[model samples]
Target chain A: MTVKVQREDFDVGAELAAMTRGKTSIGGVTLFVGLVRDMAGGESVSAMTLEHYPGMTEKQLEAIEAEARARWPLDDALIIHRYGRLEPGDQIVLVATASAHREAAFESCHFLIDWLKTKAPFWKLEATPEGERWVEAKDSDDAAAARWANQDGDQKG
Target chain B: MKVLYFAWLRTKIGVAAETVDLPPEVKDVGGLVEWLKTRSPKHAEALANSKVVKVAVNQEHVPYDHPLSPGDEVALFPPVTGG
Candidate 1:
C-alpha cells in the first residue's frame, strides 16, 4: 500500500509500474485519474487551490486505503492526491488497485475513490471571474458514499 | 490545545492556528465551537453558518458532539469538496 499527498505533480506510469513490479501473481490492474474540471456551477474556472491539513490529510487517506484493502483481496493499492494551486486540465488525484482477478481490482479501486470523496480532509477553493469561492460538497457525493454503508450481502460495496 | 483553521475560515478568522485552554464547560466539539465564536467578531462571522462548517478532532472526521480532551488537535473548515 502507498498513499501520498504532495504539492508536486505525479507520474502515473511510474507509479503503476512500481506497484506491479515483483508481483507475479497479479493479473489485473484498475486505475483512476481525477482532473480539475474547467467548468463548475456554470462558471468557467480560472484555477483551483486545494488546501489540506498537513498531518491529517495523510492519516485520513491511509485509513481510507486500509478500509479498501480490508474489504477486498487486493494485492496492492496506491493513492496519490495533489494539493496546492492547480489550473483546469491538471491531474488532481490517482487511485490504483491490483489483484489476481479483475473483479477484486475493479471493485476495490472504485471503493477507494468513493470513500476518498467524502472522507478525505482536502478542501477546494476555486478562482473564477466573479471572485474566489470555496467549493461546496455536493449532496450527490454524500449520496454516492452512502451506497457503500449498505452492504450487499457477503460482498462489500 | 491547538485549534487550526483552513480555507476561508483561515482568512475570516485572520489566523491559521492558536492555542486555547479548554474551559470545563467546553466538553465537546459543539461547546468548543460556541466558545470560539466569543473570541472575536471575525470568529462569530466565520462560524455563523455552523451547519455548513465541518470539524475534525485529532485528524479524524467527527460530528459536532464528539468529545474533546485538553490536548487534542481540532480543526475547523467547510465540508470537503475534494475528489
Candidate 2:
C-alpha cells in the first residue's frame, strides 16, 4: 500500500496499475476520487487550502488502511491526498482498493474514504463571500461511518 | 516547550508559534490550555470556546487529558475540514 500527501496531481490509473502489477489473482478494483466542490452548505467557495501534519498524516492514513485490511481480503490499497492551495473542481483525494472479489474491494474502498473523512488530520479552509472560514464537520459523514459499524456481523471474507 | 498553532487558531491567536515554560502543574494538553487562558486576555477569549479549538500532542489528535512532558510539542487548531 502507498499513502502520499503531496502538492502535485496524481494519475489514478497509473497508481492502480502499479499496485495491481504482477497480480493475476485480483479480480476487481474499486476507486474513489473526491473533488473540491464549488459550493458548500449553500455558500460559494472560491478556493480552498488544505493543511496537514507533515509526519503524522501518512501514519494516520496507513492505520486507516490497516483497519480496512483487517475487515476485508484486499490485495492492495492506495491513498493519495493533496495539500496546499486548491480551487473548485480540483481533485482532492483518491482511494483505490483491489481484491480477488468485487464485494471486498468495493466495500473496503468505501469504508476507507468514509473513515478518512472524519479521522484524518487534514483541515480545509474555504474562501467565501463573507470571508475565509474553516469548514465544519458534517453529521452525514458520521452517519456514513456508522453504517459500516452496524454491519459488523454480515461481512464476508 | 514549543507551541504551534495552525489554521483558524493561528488566525485568531495572530501568531503561528510560541515558546514558554509552563508551570509544573500544567501536566497535560488540557492543563496547558487552562494555563494559556491565563496568559493574556486575547488567549482567554480565543480559547474560551471549545467548539472552535482542537488540540494535538506531538502532531496526533489528542484529548484534553493527553500527557505533556517537558520539551514536548503541542499544537492547537480547529477541527479538520479536509476531503
Candidate 3:
C-alpha cells in the first residue's frame, strides 16, 4: 500500500501502472478520482483551500487502507491526496486498488475512498461569492462509512 | 502553549494562531477549552457550541479527554469536508 500527500499533480495512469507492476496475478484494477466540484450544498464554489493535520493525515489514510486490505483480497492499493489551493477542475484525490478478481478490487477501492472521505483529516475552505466558508460534512459520508461498521469486523491497526 | 485554529473555526475566532499559558489544573483538551472560554467573550462564544469545534493535540485528532502538556501544540477546527 502507498499513501501520499503532495502539492504536485499526480498522473493517474502512471500511478495505476506503478501499483500493477510485477503483479501478473492481478486480473483487475479499480480506481476512483475526486475533483473539486463547482458547487456543493447549494453554494457555488469558486476555489477551495485544503488544509490538513500534516502528520496525522497520512497516518489516518494508512489505517483506512489497512482496513480495506483486511476486508478484501487486494494485491495493492494507492492513495494520493493533494493539498494547498485548488480550483475547480483540479484533482483532489485518487484511490486505486488491484486484485486477482474484479469483485474484490472494485469493492475495496470503493470502500477505501468512502472511508477516507469521512475519516481523513483534510478540510476544505470554499471560496463563494457570499464569502469564504468551510464546507460542511455531509450525512452521505457518514452513511457510507456506516455500511462498513455493520460487518462487526475489526479495523487493522 | 501554542493554539492553532483552522477552517471555519479560524474564521469565527478571527485569528489563525495564538500563544497562552494554560493553567495547571487544565489536564486535557476539554479542560483547556473550559479555561479558554473564560479568557475572552469571543472564545466563550466560539466554543459555546462544541459540536462544531473539533479538537486535535499535536496535529492529531484526539478525544476530549486527551491529555495536554506545557509545550504541547493544540488545534481547533470544524469537522472535515474533504473528498
What lDDT does the true structure give each of the candidates?
A: 0.90, 0.85, 0.86
Model 2 lDDT, residue A117, Cα: 80
- lDDT, candidate 2, B1-83, per-residue tens: 99987776777778888998988899988889989989888788879987667887776678898899997888887766666
Which ranges of candidate 3 are over 4 A from the true structure?
A153-157, B69-71
Instruction: For model 2, give the RMSD to the true fold.
Output: 3.1
Taking the candidates in order, what DockQ does each have? 0.86, 0.62, 0.67
Model 2 C-alpha lDDT per residue in residues A41-148, reported as the tens digit of each score: 899999999988777678779888998999999889999999988999999999999999999999999999988886677889889998988887787877776777
Instruction: Give the range of the ten consecutive residues with the poorest summed lDDT in model 3 chain B.
Output: B5-14
Q: Residue-wise lDDT of candidate 1 within B1-83, one digit each (tens)?
A: 99999888999999999999878988999999999999999999999999888999999888888999998999998888888
Evaluating just chain A, the predictions reach TM-scores of: 0.95, 0.92, 0.94
Worst ten-residue run, lDDT, model 1 chain B?
A: B74-83
- Deviation in angstroms for A6 in model 2? 0.5
Residues A33-145 of candidate 1 have per-residue lDDT tens digits of 99999999999999999998898889989987888888889899999999999999999999999999999999888878987988888889999999999998888888777
For residue B80, give model 1's deviation from the true position in Å: 0.6
TM-score versus the correct structure, for each prediction: 0.95, 0.90, 0.89
Model 3, residue A124: distance off in Å is 1.3
For candidate 2, report its TM-score: 0.90
List candidate 1 stretches off by more than 4 Å. Answer: A152-157
Model 2 docking category: medium
